[model samples]
Every structure is written in C-alpha cells, then in structure tokens.
Target: MRNLFCPKCSERIFFEQGRCARCSQRLAFDPLLLVTRRLEEVKPCSNRDLIGCNWSADEKSRYCCSCALTRTIPNLGSTKNRLLWSRVEEAKRRLVYDLCRLKLPLKSEANQLSFDILSDDPEEGPIMTGHSAGLITLNLAEADDLERETRRVAFREPYRTLLGHFRHEVGHFCWDLLVAETQLRGPFRLIFGNESQSYENALKAYHERTDRSYDRAAFISEYASSHPWEDWAETFAHFLHIVSVLDSVAGLPLSLESRALETLRDPYLESDFSALLASWTPLAYSLNELNRSLGLGDAYPFQLSSVAIGKLHFIHMAIQNGCGISACGWRAAPVPVG
Candidate 1:
C-alpha cells in the first residue's frame, strides 16, 4: 500500500476511502487500485450496497474481480450473518489484492481459485475451514471476534486472524497450482518433506497425539509439523504476511527513524528475500513493543529459525521464478500509489 491522494483536492487519502476527507468528493471503488481505477462502466459491484463491497465491475459483469471469485457467501437472512459476510468479503478483497501484488496467476489451467464463505448452523452441523483443489472454505464464525479469540486460545495458536486464515488456505491452493507436478516439486519435497505421505493419516495422528510441547524450531507453527503440505502452507502464509507488512512499512516514513529502512524497495517486487528480513526484524520488534505497552501479547510471536528462513526463501524463489522482473509472463505490477 502507498499513500493515496484525492485526485480532486490533492489531499491525502486511503485505498478504502469512499470520499475525500478534505473535499468530500466521492471516490469510486478501484479494482486495480495501485495504478488506476479501470472505470469502464463507473459502476460498483452489485454487492456494493448489499455487502458493502466497493470495487468496480465491468458493465457486462455484476461483480468485481474480488467478488467474482466468491462461489458462495453467508446467508444474509439474519443480521449476524450479514455482518459476518461483510467482514469476510473485506478480508477476501485484501487477499486478492495481495495475490495481484505478488503477480501470481489467480486462475490456473483448469482450476480457477475461488472461495466459499459459509456459516455453521446449529441444525446444519459445523463447517471446517480448509482448502481443496482450488476452492478455499472459510467458516463465517471466524469474523466474530469473541469466537475467533476463543478458538485461538483453545488451539494455543500464537496468532489467529481472518486475513491470516485466507493467506494460509490460499497457500494450499498455490501449492497445487505452482508446485504440484512442476520442477519445483522435487525441491519442495526435500524441504517440506514428501507430500506423497498419507495426508489423512498425518492429520489424524496429529490430532490424536497427546504431546503439545514438541519443538517447533523447524516449523513456522506446530500445525505446520502435521504434514509436509501443512508445513508448506504455514511457511507460505508467513512469507505473505512478511511481504504484506513490509510493503506497508515501506509506504511509511520509517526511513527517518531507522537506517535499516532508508533504502526500502518495493517489497512485492524485491528479489532478495534477505532484504525483506532485514527491514522486517526491527519493525516486528517495534510493533511487539507497542502492543506490549498496551498490555497486549506480542504482535508477532513467531520466531524465525534458520529452517523457517530456508522455507521462506523457497517461497521467494518460487514467486521470482513465476514473476521475476524482465521475464514475467504475467503482467508486472504498475507503480503502486495506494
């Protein structure tokens, strides 16, 4: 994200800014926000008023790029479900923007990445959040703060968030599209372990295990230790989180405070993974301290070990191999202004 400006008044604004604060001019939803709004129709998604999605849609389509990928959303018959759908859509839009920044292919040869944001009803049984093939399912209860926090504590997770879930689940889908049956598969197997292992057995054993104090030095999280696929997904999510935060940090005037961030590059476009680590370490510490001051737990609690760094580097290379400068088959990101 960059410092957005109001075109009308030249006042500072934000990507989600509906109206310029200074001028009160209405700003249209930008599907391709970093560069410019491709406002062919100047029309908002049909969901704009219903679910509060503000992205623009082409005249032929009722949905925008983000909303078009959603196969299903929570039932809006109830007030609570409507609120949950709004929150889910908000996070999904952010995930789509991040994928665009990474220059990854949103649609594969046959499998187009999509989402099912559904709710668990008392009579309908519970819905588990996970990924399959190209579809990512998210439990709508994840948007409820109290319920999410309770699950986070119950699972003993270092951190849990709606966006975090999207990143992690999408990581699984990326593995199928980017890693499976590719040259990178061999290297991925070596690093993340062989995915040929029975994932069902791995998951079942993981849940049946009594010990919860296993060493997590090689994994991003304990759940990552369950299976090779999970290890890859967890590491992948962490990499995306790192890049997203670094991108936001680059947008700020942090160079004035830290020499480490003086020559910050576009994190999404940066080739060197170590460069991201260098800027991230200090920022993470500062953020953790800030959270501590407010009697909160560490904002970033995951400790990056050498093994974890290697996994992150693998993800970095995978991204570069797909969308490196001067050779990206896909479009390069335009000058990010938001």
Candidate 2:
C-alpha cells in the first residue's frame, strides 16, 4: 500500500486508479515494477476494455499477471455476478500485490496458484470458501456488504471481509507450499499443535463445545483453535494483516513522537521479528483508540501473547527462508502438541 504517483504529472494516485486526474493520462499498474505507469495501448490487457482492468499484459498472454491467476469467475452474463466478480478481482489484486512485494513464489506453468470465484447458487449446493492444493475458492456472495455483515454477526467474528478471506485462504495455500514438508513443521507443531490430527473431528468438537472459554491471547480467533492447520492459517492471515497495515502506516507522515514509528522499516522485508512487534503493538493500540473515538469498534481486537509472538516469529522465519525454494528439509517426528 505504498503511495503511488502519476509518472506523467507526479500527481498522487491510488492503487485502483485507472487514470491520472492531474495529467488526464490513462494509467496501468505494472506488477513487475510494483508501480503505476502510463498506460500503453500496445500493452493493455484484454480485460482492460471489458472490466476496466488497468494492467499491462504480455503479447502471448492477453491476461495481466493478476488476472491470469483466476481459474474460474462467476457468471459474467448476469449483471449482479459481473459486479461481484469485479469486486472480488480487486481484492485478489491487492493480495497478489502484497505477495509479490514479499517475494513469495507465484503461479507458474509448473507450480500454479489459482482462484475460483463462484456464487452461492442453490442448485450448486452450499459454497464453502476454502483453499486446496494451490487453488483458492471464494464465495462471491461475500461481495454483498449486507450478506457479509450478516454472516460476520452469525459467526461472532470481530472482523471478516473479502480481503480477509483471501489472506486466510492464501495462508492455507502457502502452508502447503512452504511449511508442510519443511523442517519448520516440528517447530510449527510445537506452537500450533499436531496438524496430522483429524481435521473433521477437531472441527466438529469445536462447534459442539458449549463452553466458549478461549485463550484469546494465544489464538487469534476461536475458529483458529479448531485445528492445527486452521491455527496456522489464522496466524498467517494475521501476519499479513500486521505487515500490510504497518506498511501503509509507514507511508504516512504521522506526527506521533515515537521512536518505533520513527525507525519503522518495511515489514515485508523486515528481518527482525521483535522490532516489528515493538512498533506494531503500540501502533495497533493507538489505532484501536482512534477507532473508538470515531464511534467504531477496535481496529484490532486480538492481543498477542508470548506463545502467539513465538508463532509469529516462526512465520517470519519461514517466509524469509522458504521463498522460491522447493524444499527447506522435512521433519518426520512431530513435537509435543500445544
């Protein structure tokens, strides 16, 4: 979420901007450069004309890097589905932007990362939004603000959004790519639990439990306690949340007189885990207070305990070492479950 500017006029632009307001020039995002550039007719994506996608495309592949990852989209023939699909695509683009910034492995012919955006049609049965292998499936019905809010309340979740879903599901995909076979699995089990435990039984137990007592300081959410895989996914999603939000805040010239903010580094490339937590803890507290002042709920409701901090550190190390590598060694024995 770095501040973007129009190359032609130096006017500030947004990530989703299709044109520069000051220069009256068409704009497109260059994923390789991670910047907005003046749109060139010869390089425009095929989707540019149809869906207002302002991204450059390769000569052989008419789809942009982000759009190319989409394996299935909702029915475009229906007006409602078209709008929902566009919103879903926007969230996906942001997710991809962050992933690329972190230098994570993206989709390729040999190792593909794809998505399926489907609507919850009655005839299609219930659409369960989740990720498997490298393919992430999303329920397009989440695009409707009211519907999402309703489900959020029903689930008793403090936060839920299309972007959050993408982050969480991508977390599952990354676990497969980076952690499942790696030596990190031992440490992962030490912190999260035995991932080999029956996932279905864990989920059923979670739902059937009458006692709602949860160690909020340890787990990001109640759903995270359902299984070790879920715990990893939830923790991974929060890691993305912390880094992305911190990156955005770093771009802003805040008048706060804090040394942590003064020495803020790029969270995506940050090597020191403690420094990130030191800066983020205070910043997140202030943000929550600001939200309260504005009559909104806490911006970040979860608190990181010692155990949670250890888990976050594990994620940091995993991303730093696992990127672009096929294997980081594997551990046959599981550690004591948490």
Candidate 3:
C-alpha cells in the first residue's frame, strides 16, 4: 500500500488509524477513493462504533467494502470475542485494500463472495477453516496467537498468519472467478496438477502421511501437497505475500547498494511476473536479515524453487487474465533488476 496523508493536517497516517496523531483530528479511510479524509467528509462504516473500524462506507451501503463482504461474524456478546473479531476484521481490511488496489474481482457472477468467522461450538466441535463456493470460513481462534501458532506447528507449516489465511482461502474463491471455467484451467492443470483428484481423500492422505515428503522443492507449503486445488491456493497465497512485501518495501534504500529497491517498480502495477519475482528475491533476503538483527525468526521462512516459481508465474498470468488488463512493449516484459 502507498503512504496516505490526512486531508486535515497532511500528517502521515497509517491504514488502521482512526485519528490523526499530529492534530488529534478524526479521520476515515474511503475505500472507493482510497484516501484518508476528515471523518465528516465521509460516512464511517456501521462497524465503526461497534468495532472501531476506520474505513468508510460506500454511499449504497452501511458497511465498508471490507465489512460488507462478511456474512457472519463470531458471537460478540463476550468482550474477549469482540477483541478477537476486531483483529480478524483489521486483517480482512488489509486484504481488501490489496485486492482493490490490484483490481482483482471480488465476487463471481454465480456466487457472491462472503466470509464467515466462527468459534468451535461447545457440542458441535471445531469449526474448520476452508472455502466453499464463494464463502470463506475462518476459525475465530485463529486470532489468538497461541492457538494459531500451535496449529501452525502441528501442521508443520513454515509460516502462518491471519493475513496468510485470508489470502489462501480467497485463492479458492478466485479459482471460481478466474480459472475454474475459464481457458486458464488448462494451463492451471498443467502446473498445479489435476484438481479432479478427490480433495477429501487428498486431505486425509496428507494428514495421515508419516514421511516428510511434502517439504520438497515442488510445492510452496507441505499442505499444498494435498491436492491441485491446494497447490493453486498455496501458490496464490505466496503470490499475494510477495506482492504485499514488495509493495511495503518499494523505493527503500538498502545498505547493500546492489540490492537497493530505490528504483523498484510497484508490485501491484508491474505486469511482468519475472520482474516482480526478481525484485522480491533480494528484498525478501534483506527482510530476513533485518529480522535476524532483531533476534527474531526469518521474516520470510519459505524458499521458492524453480517449479514453485513457474506455478507462481501461472498465478500472475491468471490474475492478469481475470482482471481484463493488457500489457505491451516494455510493459509486456520488463528486464529484471535487483
């Protein structure tokens, strides 16, 4: 995302800020305009007071573009649940911001996109996180750092986060919008393998496997080994990850003069897949080293092999195809730069 300034005081503000720190003025983020304005200039989302939402609602709706996509939210009677819901919604806002900026379609004609966030029922047991048709379900407990980390370790995942979950699940929704019935399905199959395989059996076999066969060079994550659909989803999530990271670091001057991104192209605006990946490789390494300097784990823990990179390229093309955008001349294939 690009830097946003407050319309009132012109003070730099963050995406999640509801008030400008410099002037103590009320602020609201207009999704349609993608700008920060005085609160009185735009209608705040209905969720503003309820959840402290900082985004603005469109003229036709009471909720912000992000809040409008949610069909169900976890019970908020308890204060604990309300806090958890807030964190989840914040992450969702970031996801929607990226999607809108990328010009990706949100809902398929046949299936309107939506989200359901729920906690495990006392008698019904755990609520699994997955996508069906156009609906994405998230386990409410995922907002709890301990719970999410436990599951991540149990599943042997290299990385996992609230935004990651949102990106991964939405990959399923985009499949319906961009690939399932489109011409891209053929190429998708070639790269991701045949998604015609039984997802249920694949998931079962994946969890039941004893050998560490999945942490290979072929897939982004071991869970991606479950099915072709999963492979696409995982690759799609990584695609978002790279874009988000690159966007955050755009135009930053690295100490390593050779790796500085001061002249890097914007990831969301870049049409060439190879160029985006080329910029990301050095930036990701710098991010990991920065984290190490602070005594933290690698900021980006996964490595992309050549096969994984090819799958990512397919995603880049699929997104371009889905968005009805075209590129030519220098835009068609940008020369890679570190």
lDDT by residue for model 1 (51-84), tens: 7776787567989888999998888789999988
User: What would you estimate as the lDDT of candidate 2?
Assistant: 0.78
- In candidate 3, what are the lDDT values of residues 22-75, reduced to their tens digit? 688999998888889899988899999888899999899999989999999999
Candidate 1 off by > 4 Å: 33-41, 254-338
lDDT of 2 by residue, 6-109 (tens): 88898656576789855689998888778888896448777787777877886679888889999998878788888778778877877888798789887533
lDDT of 1 at 49: 74
- Ten-residue segment with the worst summed lDDT in candidate 1? 288-297
RMSD of 3: 16.3
User: Which pairs of residues collide in candidate 2?
Assistant: none
Going through the candidates in order, what is the number of backbone clashes in each? 1, 0, 0
Q: What is the lDDT of residue 207 in candidate 2?
A: 84
| Sort by lDDT, top down from the best | 3, 2, 1
Error of 3 at 209 (Å): 1.1
